[model samples]
Target: MGQLCLVAVMVGALTLALYVDAGRQAEQNAMERMRSLAASLAVNPFVIDAVQSPNPTALLQPYAVDVMDSAHADFVTIMQTDRTRFTHRYPSEIGGTFAGSIDDALAGRTVNQMQDGPLGPTIRGIAPIYSNDGRIVAVVSTGVTVENNNSQLLERLPLIIAIAATLLAGGAIVAVGLRRYLQRVTFGRGPEEIGQMYAFYDAVLHSIDDGMLLLSPGGELVLHNDRAAELLGLTLREGVSAEHSAATGQLPSELVSLLASGKTVENEVVLVGDRVLLVSQRAARTGGKAGSSLGTLVILRDRTDLRKLSSELDTVHTMADALRSQTHEHANRLHTMVTLVELGKGDEAVRFATDDLAQGQRLTDRVMESVDEPVLSALLVGKTAQADERGIELSIVTEGRIPSGLIDVHDAVTILGNLIDNALDAVAEQASPDDRWVEIELIASATELVLTVIDGGPGLRGVSPDDILRRGYTSKPGNGFGRGVGLALVTQAVRRSRGTLSVQDRATASEGARFTVVLPITSDANLNGNTAPVTPTPDRKAPQ
Candidate 1:
């Protein structure tokens, strides 16, 4: 509305100025023509001769009338140097003194002016008529009435008004169209509402823990939250396309693939650099009934910590099962002893109880001797109990001692725990439970911690070891969520510790599969004061 008002005001002001200027121009042209006519009449021999005659009015009256009629002038007059009229269109005024000033003409000069005359306001031109002797004998004056000039201007007024109206109409139309376009772009919301929504969305996008990326349908990176840029190690910019990032190797190829596919991806686990992320994607489309594709929204959740927690949870559940199994077995043995005592066979009960106690004590003592790291020993003991419950024989071989803090307990748990668990699964899958067995070797030295696990079960038939270490690669069917991540988690931990993992198939199916992991343990002195020795008590509650 303000724009419209401004345009209207400008048009009106411009038109008014033009109108006044045009009127002035028209008046100037009319005065010029009248001056020319008066000069011509003043030079006429008939008018000059009559001006010198004794009775000038009678002879000059008809001639003046004819000149006025031919020139379409309002009036023409012939006057003497004394300012007395010689000829006038009004016959009664002939020989009367002229009412208007003609001093310049009387003094042998021509002049023009807008002044009051017999015809009221008029543009009058007066000129001197000279005798044959070059004496000023009379003056000729001609005029165009102001009323006629106004009427002429009015004739052209409609055109000027039409032009101004056209321009104003065009401006109004354009302004209205622009307003509508802005309204649509803003979703019919006012400036305040749009600003508030923008602020709110900005806050939500940055405040969330998960990473988010919005892309156009053509795979251009439209928006990315701070977390997404940090997580993916991306330096985002406006209008940077996904293909460009991929070509430059700035963005992961897997994410680029999802964006280009334009298909919804749900909770797909992908390894991005050293971090594991669970990525989900959805198509963002217009909200209309016939929805058009706008782009894709990619959501990334950093599952690195989550995956670690899950692995620790798995170890906890395994220990819990092992403890429960041991408790059940101990309870059975205790019941037997109690029954023996009730039957009055106290001597037999004592022998049986001692034998059971000695066997358990020997296994613990052997594990404690083999590994000095309390966490690894405790993990092995729990595994031993778990293996016993499943009727699988478990053996541990330790060739070297692990220095205090050489290997982080959590990393050890992740590496050894996963390998041992995979071995146990392989052994338990065998048809003959009697022949099922898992063997583990922990060899720690000043340089590295080498762990090897061999399972007596069906070998990894024709499967690549590298393929097994890949995320989401699993051989067991119906193992569910926690099945495939164990080996991948172990691989991640191993790589972080600057370690290497290898797989070896046994010579025969009866021998089973062997897996080895060698993790380099940097010395505390070489760590630049960044690490200290971890010496926690040997307990099941220790973190893996």
Candidate 2:
């Protein structure tokens, strides 16, 4: 019953995810089409290049609306900036005010809508068209009603229900499906015979997560489940390939090498800004029977955050140890130095350990200054001390003032904090007394914040950039200890800040690698840049 319940929950979740994915895909397609249409209308020769053109129809005359013209086909419309319909699907109403948010878009924003139109509630897209002077002139409105989507769902519903009822095989498990032959074979039989000999197989060449795809034995993509299109970051169009994505960010060379070898392989990969996918393959079965394999199965999970949190936990553990050591050594070292001064061997003892201890103390002191926030400064200060404790030289050089209002404080801390921590790990991975070091640089400008972490270890090698940013790809050799999640989180946060992260082999370094993150600085000139101060509302407020 527990297994059955788990299956049911998975099935239901799969259904919900599919439903949401379909809606999102449809909306995205509609918006892209709207943006393209708006761009086209803005660049129309009749509107821009012609003199004394027909006031309304001339701009729209050369291009017809992109939809089936049947009575049941979903339709779109357009309007002028002043709430006046310029041209729409019902050509007679070219000057009539359209019943939608076309007017809203004319005020200079894209309008994505599900609203009641004269033609019924439609999932409409309205975008502003700009003139030569960059003024909002006309709005392009496009839509397909939910009824159209419902029609698509109805067409797929029967297939979904049939598969659900069949309890089709998923993962490595074989399951029951409809066949009179199976019933006859199972009749009057023992458990083993009934299970193995009597079982009839149903092979579903689709995955239940993100996207699914099946490749034929000839190494061609035979079928693409919906999520596969998304995971590959492709529209449901032809010619999406594994090679295309590998060109953009990076994928494990091992996985790609395996694919190139044309042999069955299952491997996990992280698609930057997408998610982790578990891709596997086996021989495709035939004739609804066992012992046949023909194709590969690809599945995806949005483990983008889970993998991130896991690594953050690890850095936390490392940090905890660093702090523990710092605490243990601070007063004890002070007392020991005092005792050494009282002894006759004071000068010799001071010469031996004072220089390194002073280096550690200097690192700690430098880390604590010029920070507005305590938590961040404290964490970094402790990390700095711990780094010194491990014999790694730490340095922070700033070119100019660290911009105060450039980034959200929390975001700044997380991005820089995690990166520094990761640098410490990379350096400590292969740290030796002679070659123990890391450098952190804060090069800030009015428009950009450049954070670079250079370390001395094995440096960046043996992995693609994607593998470096992937969550679970860890260098620490252990079953349950360290996993590489910090880089993934940093990548995500950097993306959110509209920044870029670059990793390069530190050619000058004797040991480790260097990573640079450039983050955009949001200058305070724009009125929207100023956020309201955090003030508690009257009744909701604790005090004045």
Best by lDDT: 1
Kindly list the per-residue Cα lDDT of model 1 for residues 117-172, writing each as its tens digit: 77789998999888899888778899889999889899999999999999999989
* Reference-based TM-score of each model: 0.63, 0.46
lDDT of 1 at 115: 91
lDDT by residue for model 2 (132-220), tens: 77877666666667777667666766666666555524611432232234554455455686556534421233435555655555545
Q: After superposition, how far is residue 382 of candidate 1 from its true place, in Å?
A: 2.3
Off by over 4 Å in 1: 1-160, 164-187, 226-235, 246-254, 272-275, 285-293, 302-312, 328-370, 391-399, 422-446, 452-488, 500-517, 525-544
